[model samples]
Target: MQLKELSGQSGVSAASIKYYLREGLLPAGETVHATRAQYSAKHVERLELIQALRRIVGLNIEQIRGLLKMADDGAPRLTVLAAVQRVVLHLDTAAASGDRPTPAADAVVRLRNWPDYPSDARNALNVHLELMESLHIPVTRELLDTYSKAMDDVAGLDIAVTTAPDSVDQLILTAAVGMHMHSQLLLKLLALAQASHAIRRYEEDA
Candidate 1:
């Protein structure tokens, strides 16, 4: 496909595509002539993934480049997925900002036995603790234990689906894009369940 066709098919502007090509975010299309170039299905797929990472996952060009490199280099899927998650979920910034994990966070990690798991999970828990502190919300160990139980329940499905993808690239995309999307869906369902419970409890009083 030509640049115009690629742009149309990918739903990204030709100008942006050219910019990505120049920035090394997208691979260069095959040059057919001095000016003309041809793109393939791979380009289209790559563009779609790039767009998702940019618009949906909110990854900057550098992070996307790293993600693409990790995908192409056949790095360990779990590590690559963790790197992608850190970028997409802003975990790296959170981990960097905090000097150390809060005692509450560390206790939760020990209670949950996540020390053997990937660092991403532990880091995210620390970020949550930081948020609680910043908001002046006192979280009890008991409450954290309850939350951990719920998180573990959700994480079981999250890990299962995220690891099911056959390719490293797909897993990265899934962890970055798909998992957050699914998280939102689950939150919405939880909200609906809460609403239903509230209505059931309050309906008799009304």
Candidate 2:
């Protein structure tokens, strides 16, 4: 497919596609002539991914660039997916807020030292905290703790599944589908497990 064909199929303007090509978000197409280039299905898929990351996921160009680099380098799709998930979640929540919120000094301090959280993740979290504050949602220490614990539990399970050698593809597929289709159930199951463990601990203490 030519640039115009790709543009037509992707719903992205030809100029924007060229811009993405220049920015290294999309791979260079095959040089057919001095002025003509031919794109393939891979290019089309990548362009759609870029568009989705930008327009739907609300990632800035630089952030999308980082993600594209990671994807191109054959980094585990889980890592990219996790980062994208965090960004999309924050974007959706923030979009619902009419006003920006201020981050608590303590929350900022805690977030600053959070290990393995890239700058983009921190930015997204900051935006989410601000949105919560604007909505009068308390940025209490307990709230942060709860969020951290929930993420930790999910990440632990995800890591376990992804590391399993025998069914890696199946695991990734399950995660991709389950995270979208059964997210509520997954959350509920985690909450139930936590509640059960808490009850057991209380009973033992009593």
Candidate 3:
């Protein structure tokens, strides 16, 4: 495919594609002439991944660059996956500063008994707990337990989806897109559930 065809197929503009090529985000296609080049399915796939990272996953160019480097580094599949998860999670150690929510959060984790869970996930929970505290919201054990159970279900579903038998590229693509989609799905589901409950509780006898 030519540049125009590549752009059409990738849904990226030719100008943007050229910019990605220049920025090393997308590798150059085969040279057919001094000014003409031929792109292949590989180019299309790479462009999709780049687009997914940039538009869906909300990564900056530098973050995408670093992630691409990790993907191409010949690391073990699971190791590469961990890096991808960290990126998707936007894990920030700095956000977890001050009094750690470890003891409280770890109590929930231990209750859930989720083995092999990353510590950064714990940190993320602590960050949220800290925020809730700052807002002067009560952080009850019962609330943590209920939320942990719900999150465990969500995390299980996500793990099942991402760990399905698929190519590395497919798994990476899913990780980039799935999390955002799942968040939206949860919001919609909550709205529907709330509406149903309201109708049941408030609607008059018909």
Candidate 4:
């Protein structure tokens, strides 16, 4: 199809498509003649990914470009996936700082019998623990375990949806979009559950 058809199919304007072509966010199509290019289904797919990153995940142009590069880089699968996860999580590139939450967080992770998490993952937990401590909130093992069990269910769903896809870019895009949107799913689920339970427990007074 031509650029006009591509734009119509993808619901993107022609000028924005041209801008993406120039920005390296979208790859150029096959040159059919001196002034015309022929796009294919792949181009439409790429445009959908680009629009989701922008409209759904709220990633800017540079982040989307970088994410595309990371997904397409010929690194080993696990390495590329780790890179994508870090990008989606917005974790720092540097190694963990080994701050106050490391040991306790490490203990909880070990107790959960999960793999030895990377320092960055541990540190994300640690930072929150530190904040809770500063606010005098009790960080109990039972609470940690409860939250871990709930998140294990979520992580299982993440793997089910993101890992089975053959396209690495699709995997990355699914993870990015799912994590951003489904967090709200969890939040709203909690709110609804609480409301239902509270309604059930309400006692009518005489």
Candidate 5:
């Protein structure tokens, strides 16, 4: 495909594609002639991913470049995942090394017995646990176990999409952006469920 075809297929403007090329975000196509270059489906995929990262994930060009660079350099998926979690979007992935993990957080880890839980995620969960504790809300092992079971399914969905991705960059960015968008949907579902349960309980009590 030509550049114009790529732009049309990608739904990105030719000017913008040129800008991405200039910024080294999109690799140049094969030079088929003095004035023509050939592109392929890979270019389309990159452009779409780039657009998603920019418009959906809200990552700036430099961060996207860095993330893409790690993949291009043949970094492993875990390394890319860590970089995205820690350095890319600042979306729930920041934690200091010396910070303490709450008891509930540690318990959740022990129940799972899983190594490689991201520290920032544990810290994020700790914040919720502490808040509930302060509010005199009980967080029991049974509750955590149930929630953990539910999230295991969610994790499966999360991982399943990125499992066969073409590259580490594709996998991480796809997961990151998809998680960002679906997180809102998940919260909305939770709220609706809570509202329905509250209504049901109130009617029963009445």
Candidate 6:
């Protein structure tokens, strides 16, 4: 198919498709003429994936590029898919405005002004704020403090689990499958483990 046909079929604008091709996110089409190029089904699939990353996952252009590279290099689609699912879940929970006031819209503005926050956390915060705003929930300093504490606790545990040296791939696979198949059971296991460890530590201190 020609560039125009590809663009029309993908619902991506011709100029944007050209930009993606220029940026190396999309593969170059076969040159049929000085100004005409032919795109194939692979181009169409890649363009769809890129669109989903941007529109559904709320990833920025740079992040999308990195993801595309990883995808093309044969990294597990499950990993990328998991990350995208996480982002979409966050957006759904946090963007209560029914897709109108998504975190992506706020993140674009916030990143332009603030240079300190880590990109991932900043994006998450943007989603949280947008969600609150849409729900008319007051974002008090106390509420922020509580949220920060909760995040700190979860982050500590995540770091510990993710950093464990043996079979990181297996661990990720377990997490992915476990979370999918038995979410409540997984939560229960984690909760019991935490309680047991806390009790043991308290007894030792006493």
lDDT of 5 at 21: 93
**Strongest candidate by TM-score:** 4
Q: Model 1 Cα displacement at 53 (Å)? A: 1.7
For candidate 4, give the lDDT.
0.78
C-alpha TM-scores of all predictions: 0.77, 0.47, 0.79, 0.85, 0.80, 0.41
Tell me the whole-model lDDT of each prediction, alpha carbons only. 0.81, 0.64, 0.78, 0.78, 0.78, 0.61
* Steric clash count of candidate 3: 0
Question: Per-residue lDDT tens digits of candidate 4, residues 1-206?
Answer: 99999999999999999999999888899999999999998888888888998998787888889877766565666666665556566655433553445556876777778887565556667776776777999888888888888888898888788777787667767877887778778899999999888877884421
Candidate 1 lDDT over residue span 1-206, tens digit each: 99999999989999999999998878898999999999998888888888888888777889899889888877887678788777766677665545455788777778788654537656676777888889999998889899888888888888888888785656776788866687688799989999999999999999
lDDT of 3 at 141: 83
- TM-score, cand. 6 vs. native: 0.41
Q: Whole-model lDDT for model 2 versus the true structure?
A: 0.64
lDDT of 5 by residue, 64-121 (tens): 8987788778888877776776544363543343146788878877887767465656
Better of 3 and 6 by lDDT: 3
**Best of the candidates, lDDT:** 1
What is the model-wide C-alpha lDDT for candidate 5? 0.78
Q: Pick out the ten consecutive residues of candidate 1 with the lowest summed lDDT.
A: 93-102
How many clashing pairs per prediction, in order? 0, 0, 0, 0, 0, 0
Native-to-model Cα distance after best TM-score fit, residue 106 in candidate 2, in Å: 19
Task: Give the worst 10-residue stretch by lDDT in candidate 3.
Answer: 92-101
1-206, model 3: which lDDT tens digit per residue? Answer: 99999999989999999999999888888999999999999888888989998888888898778767766675666776666766776764437462365666777877788663655666677787777778998877888788789988997899788767455666678876787678778889989999999999889864
Flag the better candidate by lDDT, 1 or 6.
Answer: 1
Worst 10 residues of 2 by lDDT: 92-101
Q: Residue 122 deviation, candidate 1, in Å?
A: 2.1
Displacement of the residue 201 alpha carbon in candidate 4, Å: 6.2
Say which prediction, candidate 4 or candidate 6, comes out ahead on TM-score. Answer: 4
Q: Candidate 6 lDDT, tens digit per residue, 1-206?
A: 99889988999999999899999999899999898889998788777767765764456788667656755676664455455435433432443333344444344444344344334435556666776777998766555555455545664565464445343233333333333334355578779989999999898877
Off by more than 4 A, model 6? 77-206
For every candidate in turn, the CA RMSD to the true structure comes to: 3.1, 9.8, 3.3, 2.9, 3.1, 13.8
